[model samples]
Target: MPLRTWQTTLCSFVIAGALVGAAGSATVTPALAQGPSAPADFTAIARERMPAVIAITARQRVRERETAPALPEDLPFREFFRRYFEERMDPREALGAGFVISPGGHVVTNDHVMGNAEEVQVVFGTSTRGPVRLVGRDPATDLAVLKVDPPPRMMVTAWGDSDAAEPGSWAIAIGSPFGLGGTVRVGVISAQSRDIRSGPYDDYLQTDALINRGNSGGPLFNARGEVIGVDTAIFSPIGGNVGIGFAVPSRVTRSVTDQLIRTGWVERGHIGVSLQELTPANAQALGRPNEMGVLVAAVEPGGPAARAGLRVGDIVTAFSGNPVESGRHLSRAVAAAKPGTEARITVFGDGRTKELA
Candidate 1:
């Protein structure tokens, strides 16, 4: 199934992108005493946290190529027959949501929501609205940060642990769905560690939080009003919220957002190699049916992996002693690593576990 970006208002649907926004922390924040099982002051918490949920309107230029005008052959007067339309790109404004992450007014939202943004504006409510500056964006993770001069009484939201968020736990989402600002919806965590294959790091928290179009880059908070995920996409056949939505987990968002806040863009360590998944169908032929690994399909001659003694036909089982689940898992791990660092790798060859390289 193809997941749309949840970006709208430009002859496109409101549902697109698989996840949204920045997560603040990797550590677990405790839920309230009377958490999801027993509702307590839901309205109050929503009110307190509501200010952090901001609406975003990004105006972007849609570029189009213009070809030279063609003259008609049937016309007696070729000059009169010739016609041309001025080559112009249309400017469009897309609406999404974000939450404040810093006291200095750092906001987080989905990158897809701000496609080629020429200008951006953030609104806290009906009264507070102003132009904002783009801090950084990571399209690979569908996350971005914005710097806004928050109005008086605006507050920031804290990041909760998506890793600690259990299935069936209560979830709250706040965004500008259909450009309706400060809309709140409630549901539960449907599942965790779901891979919708949106990116190299595809671990998404599945929730039934009634996320819809224009909810892109919104915050999905737990019962304690802590942000655990960014509302980005919905799994709907009919474009409306069907209760199945996906969010980018805090564990991944936290790291990416921090880097973005420090720098205008993100940089990742590269290990040049092409990999094919090791699966049951093909693993049997390699004498390793049950074990998980990826086939080293192609190794660049002078690349990091090759220089570290990796060869084509090798089955990469682990990296730095951590088991690699798939090609994507290894790729994400390598990207997360610091550049110019030594790599510890384990592979399979000759029908046995190969020594670390």
Candidate 2:
């Protein structure tokens, strides 16, 4: 059967190269008791953290030949043409930056950097250095881990609590943009929980830092000199910084990076339901005064929502006690929920509020 127009109107979060600021207003930090806010000492922070920062280059392997097609014995074939293309151009090389996280040679970078890389190299500190090895990567969060056995005394960047980082707080970026290693840009946290449509868990810390091409997978630091975010993408049409950049929050990266280091990938709970935004017409049909909740267009058979008794045309007002304001909000909540655990969902159905497990 053809799906209804309302069902087709549903929107799932997709990767958009946008950095959404805080929902309403940006949150500012109070001035230090000593005096008015002072400029963050980027020099001091860079000095303490730059040694751990390393430049990463990913080399992709290009297969020069494929399986030869079988032909009839009578067909005239040209075997010389296949050998002629052997001296073709080499595969492209991708460049990005990473930082050492552990003493045992654990490093962190964006997964996209190592996505197609058959050979990975890690350059510690400045370019006047040796290479390292590629470990594991998590594409969902755009994080990768690399390992390099240095000459001992490897420096590391301390990770800050991303949950405590408020909007309007100072954010400093250090990365290799345009292949220039050890570059720095300064800005403020423009927003939080920004869904940049980059990945399923798209919660990003939006910043107004001057980020540009080649800065992907770099560190976003707070005034305390702790790493809070990883510079990944920017929102610009000209490919230059227009004072808007997005960083993967440490809250998300820490967990994903840890898992990637241990295992080879990160696992996310999936409910397999088609999520739709609550429109005025749909709300009216459900007897809602206004469009407020997310609608469940279709629940996967035997999936989490289906097992929880969620149904079509039901408006989910809350997920696991968190009030859901839109489809995007609800989707994030559900995606973050732990699998195999029952969650309470408040829904509006048949002109009445109902609770479903």
Candidate 3:
């Protein structure tokens, strides 16, 4: 089967699973307790958010080598003939979803969706199509921004506070699923702060909303019809939605998109150090409580951490007065900090605690 057809079939087969998986063995908060009386109608929210949602098609040229066909060994004088072969240049199209974030034609979507494409087209509603220019992309967060010359008076969606989104709150996903544009799937935020091991910064919002192959870069809206997340990837062994979809939270999306728009790149603060999680045994050996903080294993020769006098075997307990719960917590804090800014770091070593600037 063709790749497109396989993807369509997978999405069709898993629609029911995506809808029903929310009822699985996961705890969800009651909707009435979330906000004002349960949203009387999701239809209204979908209608309001659909205009900002868009379908994106990216085209790329790929070179593929032809494979030799298998032949019976007894039938052939294969050695007497030379196979004439040449690589074929094939044009491939990838489908995804995005939303208009500004009236000036700034659109936001997953960077993977925009994957090194030679050309991109944005489709609004059903038929309004326009070519888009890649403004910026950040692969670390899997987010990208595109610019289009959209007609005046285009509808835009506002970014919601992803930090305010709690598990059990309603999550509505609008996007092109299997190339079917204007599709909406409703479910609840099953979990938050999900690290699917996708990247160094792995903070993702997990949802049971039906995010399939073509749903990448689509907006995941809260009950208020504000975009709280951008659907990115799904955890499925079968290449379909298994009720384990992950989205780049708006908190990260906003930070990345803002920087990308301004600088065309994300400048992350780096304190060069290799860190290891403080396991119970390591902590006990270090005469500290179990799993207290991250242990510094190595410091770069001339990096910020080394210049700040950070050394191997040092336990980083906190950063800028915030407690470091784990290696990930410390990494995230450092990455989010502005470069060139001085920060207070707390570390424990040599049977004593010291504060470093």
TM match of model 2 to true structure:
0.79
lDDT of 2 by residue, 1-357 (tens): 653332112222221112122245578998865734756467988888888887777787666655455545565554554454544546978888877778887878888877787777666664444556666777777888877785468887889998877888889888888788888888899999898787766889999987776678889999888999998888988867788899999988888788778777665556667889888887787777668788989988887667666689888887655678877776666655555555566777766677665
Q: Judge candidate 3 against the unseen true structure and give its global Cα lDDT, from 0 to 1.
A: 0.83
Please, what is the TM-score per model?
A: 0.82, 0.79, 0.86
Off by over 4 Å in 3: 1-34, 69-86
Better of 1 and 2 by lDDT: 1
Between 1 and 3, whose lDDT is larger? 3
Which is the leading candidate under lDDT?
Answer: 3
Best by TM-score: 3
Ranking by lDDT: 3, 1, 2
TM-score quality measure for candidate 3: 0.86
* Tens digit of per-residue lDDT, candidate 1, span 137-194: 9988899998888787778899999998889888899999989999999999999978
Residue 110, model 1: Cα distance from true site in angstroms: 0.6
Clashes of each: 6, 5, 0
The ten-residue window of minimal lDDT in model 1 covers: 8-17
**Per-candidate RMSD vs. true structure?**
11.7, 8.4, 14.1
Residue-level error in angstroms, candidate 3, position 223: 0.3
